[model samples]
Target: MRWARAIHHLEALAQECAVMATRPASIFPVRVVELWAVGDVLGPLRDIDAVTVALAVDLPVEEVPWLGQPRGAQQWANATRLDRNPIVGLWRSVHAPVWNHRVERPALVWDAENGVAEKTLAALHDGAGERVRLPAPGAEEWRARLTEELAVSVRALRDCTAAYEQRRWSPGKLEPVADALWRASEGYLDVLDALHGPPEPT
Candidate 1:
């Protein structure tokens, strides 16, 4: 399944990040690498959820399953015109969050990331100092545990995909597998959160 493949890619990225973190290097560089690694995995993680949702909804396999439709020229022009309007622009700038809330946002893989890359970056920075102070497990052990958990999550996703393909009309058929996948993914994210503390206040 595409979702399973994405998770596998995430596992690989996590392993790479863990190894880099363990290397004898300055803390700043190590943290930088970790932030970059998080950025790298974000794509695959998004893909995993996107594909899973597409499959769950029985979207045609031949069709590209985008979570949100691309804006057309007219839509872009309207947005540009609105931004050019000084009065509207001023109001939007003052109430950016409220204005943004009205926009359609994709259902991102990690809701904690808030579909904002800056939040993820802030998360890394917020945790970097504390992570250095925390006593972490051995690098090899950490990698092994994450790899194992990811493997199980991948397998669950694969099984769910197969079940969907075979008997899609069967109600609740994919629930167990989907639940397992969700739990496993959450566990993986929890491990990372532990390693790097929570995101800083906006």
Candidate 2:
């Protein structure tokens, strides 16, 4: 009942803020359709806890003008953390990445169905709450796409490792390098799998 109530509350907030823009841009860079709570609300009771809400927004919060804060240092600082009232909780929930000196927002699959899939994936992976589940769209398609990319990356990493090992004919040096590469590649592949689901067998 708490989970349902929480969802209902978030849904109402999303609707109210859906059309409200924060000066230069909207608080939700993406047109929010889903509000993903970061943790399982139904978990074992604790004295106190914090709830984080990740939104399925149209754009990344970092790029939004009010969020980007190009004018001054104070503004930029505020933008980075998204310390504004009303939706600060949602802003902090979403992950923002930086590249080429610019904060990059999520380039989400914008399709309505994929939006649900994205939220479902996040809940499964982040919350680890199997009871909270939603059917993912294009499961087969995602599997296939990720599979091809995985194969290519794996092959390339293998070749690179082989070449690096060959460069130094000493087993003592080669063994450690090979081992490190193996572990690194495995971890990298696992991350990719987690993001898009495992690649299906050919």
Question: Against the true structure, whose TM-score is highest?
Answer: 2
Please write out the lDDT profile of model 1 over residues 1-202, one tens digit for every residue.
2534534433333343344334443321212121122122223223322211100111221111111111131232242242232211111111111111111121212211222233433333333322222234466755564454344335544554575566556666676445444544454354445444656889
lDDT of 2 by residue, 1-202 (tens): 3444444443444334333323234332333333444434323333213333444344433222111221132342254332332222322112322111111222221123333344533443333434443223366655563454345446545654776667567555575455545644664466366556688999
Model 1 earns a TM-score of 0.23
The clash number for model 2 is 5
**What's model 2's overall lDDT?**
0.38
Q: Looking at candidate 2, what is the lDDT of residue 164? A: 67
Give the whole-model CA lDDT for all candidates, comma-separated: 0.30, 0.38
Error of 1 at 116 (Å): 45
